[model samples]
Target: MGNSPRPGLWALEKSTDYGKSFKPWMYFSDSTHIKDISIGGRCMCNGHADTCDPADPNADSNILYDAGVDEKHQSLDIYGRYEGGGVCQNCQHNTEGINCNKCQPTFYRPSGKRWDEIDVCQQESGRCECRKEFNPPNCDSCAYGYFDYPNCKPCTCNLNGTEGQHCTPTDGICPCKYNYAGQSCEICEDGYYSAQCKNCNCDTSGTEPSICDDVTGQCICKLLHGGTRAGACVRALRVRPRRLDRRQLLGRRQVQLPHQLWRQAVQPPNFDSVKCDRCREQFYNYPACEECNCDPRGVVASFAGCGSVPAGELCQCKDRVQGRICNDCKPLFWNMQEYNPYGCEECRCHLAGTLGGLGACDTRSGQCECKSHVGARTCDQCRDGFYRLQGDNVFGCTRDCDKQSGQCRCHSRVEGRRCDRPIRAHYVPTLHQYQFELEDGVTQSGPVRYRNNEDTFPGYSWKGYVLFSMLQNEVINVVQIPKSSLYRLVLKYMNPLPDNVRATVIITPESVVDIQQK
Candidate 1:
């Protein structure tokens, strides 16, 4: 009923037409049926149908082809033809199939190449394994105190012991230590010595041996003359002396004896004497004769030599004219007025005339100038009709008389240049006429007259001595007389004699006449 089957594997209609059609292939239970139906004896019903050839089963064939077959199925039947089943399954390049298990020289694999594989990559060495002359690891770094070399070796020594490599030490190069001397410790000369060889003797002459072997001790000596030598003595030529005299050197035997020396040589006594150049003055001995003796009234002790005295010499006054030998005042004299020894006594004079001009009384001539209105040789007191005023030296006269009136210009109470009068009570007299006698034997009279019932009289009452004999029980009153009256003043007093009274009197200066009343 169905069309006879094709050979090899049956193809779906879609596979035969490259999937363009949809007819499905048939499958049979026996190959006899397929061979009887198709011209090829091969059957198409079995899976080996692809191995069957249409021409001949025994003929060489390109079995890989099937029209419209899938690419995956193309190689599916070739497994038995190659050495390994699949393309690489049992080939030499197949890692699992071969016994070649080692990895390539330069290549490495962390996982095993085979069941017991070994890793083949090289391991790195650490920095410590590098050489000293070069830097670690790669030999690229240089060591301490060295520099890198072109060949990778480090440059070793610093040159000339200076800055570069290969350096060496030289002479005259080291610094000297404290207290040491020498170009190179040559023998220690005069002052110096020691180990770093520095030290000195430091003596006055610089000739002394070093005390502490020139190292430890310093020079010590007397000031100025001192040095390292402890007890060194200075020469006598350095001493200085003050005085030089042959007479002063009695004990020294250095000089030859003089001719007069042996004659009086037992013991030349030391003489201490002073001589006077003028009559009684004296001087201390010999060469530097300085001091002198002076007289009681002389002044030579102050002056040094005879030549120092002035010419026309005398033991004179210490000052100009003061002392004895013309040294003191002559006779009854005083030295009041002038200065110095030349001063002489003063002359006596009145205070008013001399106080401003001459100072004191003149002892040489006892004369003095009289003050105005005063007339004594010494001018010690005031004259008649004048009086001494307030001060000791001042004087004044009674006021002048007024000739026309015969009355004083000033009343008796006022007695100076000015007529300023003192006031007092008026006097009244009982008698018509009265005679008055003064103690000094002077007398005056006046007619007792009345002026306004009060008797007016001359005001000449002064205190002095008056001698008058009074008659028993007869009281008498004496009063002043005015200059205008014509009565004669009596030197004696006579009372009207309640019967007859008479008294006798004597007046002075031998001039004023007495009036005898009847």
Candidate 2:
């Protein structure tokens, strides 16, 4: 307070309740300044309500008086300036204590300062450049995916192909999507599958070109589908390609007409060669050249040239090869050319009898040249004492019969000078000199022997009693036939006596030897 209209006085604490209520905080005088009222003291002045007066709170503090002013005597001469509470002098409205060392509201002390600097607080950016999370206002704590100090750095999640605005808080790592590999999800590896990157299924043995389609992973079909659809000659139908034709226009060099040249289906793009491939009429397209349908042995020759070669002018065959297609044999097989299926049978030439082992039979006559005694178209016959069982040219003769002499030739199974002896035991009369034993130790002493039932052998057994009817000396002269000649034995059995004996005689095959019994 500086001026006043009346003479009055100001008071200090003058607490109404000992020291509780600090009210009536006005000057006791008139015309007081808020600054002086804020400072409590015994300040007094003189003047009417309309005249001059020290109306400030400081008018109560007499210790704060001017030396030339006095309130009660209305004099200019005042005294008593020495006092204890002078620090609040000229204190601003915002200040509190005896000293004006503090600032007003909305202001604070700046942290970290020297003692010389006033401790008064000041207005700031509402932040000390902190809080990366907040935007323009006060800098509070940082947001989720951001780290703050002075700079608001976005969380870069290690570039591992992660998505979204916020990366993992702990490590800044991110998750990747499907089928995408590498750090940035930038690459699709392998091949395209289901619209996604996948591995290829390439055949190890039959992979063609590069084995796989670099994009879709569907097997790549290079070439004009000429090879297998999958590059292998499997049984499935192949994927056909658009064929290029002459009329399609390319100056005409090659062709792939269906059956024209079945042998060379893949024609040369240039037709300047001296020769052009052509298949026979019977030939069909099977990737490679196939042989004619006619019999190879009968088809003497063939011509091929897009059917330009007349059928009538086909390769001519000899008369021997007779047929519409020259696929037949002519003349008798024995005398004709060596042909297959329509040719002659092999000549049955006996080793010793046929043309002195030359085996050169008469082809014209189909006659086999035989030895002296052997008589047959094949020269494989034998005499009475010998026989030819069956014939096989691989062996020396027909079975065991000698071809030249028409005689029995011993096989390994039998033994004898003439192969007439059965080494095991003769069960038949087939041998010249072999016996069938009816029983062992067979005599007239047993009833079984007398009844002809000693034991029936494989063949008939002989057991008989002999008797001589002549009572006088009958010395019969008999001739013994030699082994060199053929012979037979004749026997006669009759009455049985103790002294008299019956004899059976052996004679030549002509019955020349005589016999006498007594």
Candidate 3:
């Protein structure tokens, strides 16, 4: 309508009966501008096409008068901005649409492809294009065991040391196995060793703490220290006795007394009073002087700077110290100190709970060699969930127990925390007696005989008593208490040698409340 070449007339709809009836009114006309227009058909294709067929269903059956139209005027001719619609014939660049602007089947427009480009729609190749270690097709995900897409690489993981084959996607670090660690599970965690990755039980003081040979699990001991646990100074440093050459001993202080001086000499010219000008606390023995350097902390205070022998033989050391300089601790002791009279504290490790059932402990820290499940500085007690520390038991305690209750599994006939004794039976379901035969439980130290005398008439179920000579005087019995409660002890003995015989009764390892009778 804006491009019409001739002027036209137009009118507005007028109604007087409330829009019930209408007629054309208010006529207007324009000569320079198009006031009104009408057309038979028009082309609506975009710039991708230059012609439209009026017979096509997508285009309008309208005809227009323009200076650029052909003489026949059967079809519209325009590059873009066509008003009529029609399917663009022989679409360009494999494109197909009402305006010839979209890609056809089996083809796709590459990202950022311009619509005006001749080859904007590329044909599908039926193949995936992906970077290395990335999944095919869309390439939006990483391949198995690979991560960090667009720059993907194989997962660096140690199959034996990692918990799983894959690693964390973002960082590419695998979850480490027990006692194993690293970004790629390449090394063992601290205080662990070997391909198996076991804990490094290095001595606390004798060896460097929390470190050992990675492959062999051997402890690296401190200076002058070595043992099963590297807990002691294996060799003692002893002072060599000083010896004098015959000529030096004879001529150095020898003097053939002159006849006049010999008559006045009383006690060998008082050799003790002789003193050398160069002699000091550190150097002694005059002509053959040597350094008297002794450890002040481990040696006697008065002998810290001097010794009687040229080689410091008389450097008196404090207790548990035995060296020329008194610098090293004695075996089974550790941590030398000035104020300590014994020079070092003893390694008082519990034999039962310590590693290998040894009393050796760390020299610097004095920490005992503890078993896997033992604790405390002395390693005397079992950790929670265990009990009954026996030296022969490698793990330091019995692990089969109720951790919360400290109760052991029992047999059908036994009932106790330790399952040590037979259960008491109730004959009438109302009364019961908890008793044990002495002959069956008591451990005797000598040849003891068990006999029964029914004529004594103690009870119908009385078993027997043990008899032994006076040489065998001690007996042992082990009992496990069922619960925490007060208990009474009773003892019986026979006095065959009746000279107003007196007997003493004793119980071992007194508990919270202790009592004895004689």
Candidate 4:
């Protein structure tokens, strides 16, 4: 019998003649007086189940235990007399309680859903519903472990060596760690050693060959030198090695003997050497070993270590100077003796007119390199036939231009300093003629023919040049005046007639004037 109460209507019947006829003897109703009997006399299945069955004694009672919950339910059976069962089946609305009264584990009944409806429960679709370390909406991909599709076999990765907790799903390979290598980032890379993977830091000069022990990170020091980092060679003196400071061990290959050792090694019995206070000429101040002073304008500031007085080592000089003192100018510079602030003046040869176009020139005379055809003192101007002096051109100019003014000759319709554009025709917007031409109002009468010659005529001449022959030929032109104003007219002509022959000109309408030409 099940531990929980059973839910069913109960009635007693007496049978006679061995399963033939039966008579009703007792019926337990809602008002019946029974001890510990619950009201309603039915299973508590909410609205999902319509009926309930009695407990089967041979059945596994563990199936009735929902997640280990065994709370008693209200029913019509007597308490503690017999275990009542409310085992419900044929659940609806996606509910899956033992009594068919609750939503399935993977689904939920949304707010405002009716109990009997088939869609009362819905599956959770949000990615946040997945496991904490799982990936994707369905949680099918594994992170920080090997993949098995919706499941994972966890494998640890080195936090210091790997960029993230995630590993390659196929091979479970973690990324390389800082200064570490291998599939799982388990060991240090070359030149580094130990669990912490520190650099060897071997001394480059004091050690025979700068390499350290792979495990201990210890360097091999040369003779007269010692220490993990390979200390400098020490000089023989009365003072013990322990007196030398750690700072005295590092730096350049050669250093002056320590002051303690100098005094012990060279001081006389009278101790007069103790009075010596001045630094040697090679240094500005001794003991501290300060470098010699150099002219800032002449030498590179970063390399100002000038050697001894009579020229021992040449200090690095600025762009256009030389000599140990950096006082002299280079071959390409001039006027160094004047003590110019910038050392010397660079000969700025014009690149266009320079022989090799490289700005090479004479240093002493300040003469710039010049091409054979470039004769100017500065080599900036082009010769007689060339124009448009430019740096990119081979001869510093394009040829074929007017020799006197260096102006290029262009076609009649083209106009520009370089003859690269077309001349636009002029238009009078207020004029009555729809399309006006140069010969618009001119009338050529009797043996006169029209001709056009743009090259032979001046640019402002109308319709180019026109010719007329014979004495009876005549040309008449009409003019329109937009406003009253003083005007001048000039006519140019070429006639084959004798020099003594006379020609008559006439102007009429609105103050006409006539003149005779011979």
Model 4, CA-based lDDT: 0.54
Candidate number with the higher lDDT (1 or 3): 3
Model 4 CA deviation exceeding 4 Å by range: 1-319, 323-328, 375-378, 400-518
Q: Which ten residues in a row have the lowest lDDT in candidate 3?
A: 262-271
TM-score of each: 0.16, 0.16, 0.24, 0.19
Per-residue alpha-carbon lDDT of candidate 3 for residues 1-518, written as tens digits (9 for 90 to 100): 68877546677889999999999887777755874453333544445555543334343332233333333332332544443333445456688665566788988776567766777888764334455577643477876677676667778887578766566667777888878888778788766666667776776477655455555455655556654442221222233335533432211112232231222222111122223334444556554455666788788655635655335264678888867678887656789899888899888889889776666655567777788988898998989867788888889888867779978877587778987767887122211324544566554454345667655434334557655458545555545556555555545545456576544455554475655423
lDDT of each candidate versus the true structure: 0.35, 0.40, 0.61, 0.54
TM-score of 4: 0.19
lDDT string, candidate 1, 203-239, tens digits: 5453323333343233432223433432211112222
> lDDT of model 3 at residue 122?
80
lDDT of 1 at 351: 49
Off by over 4 Å in 3: 1-293, 301-304, 307-314, 400-518
Residue 485 lDDT in model 1?
Answer: 44
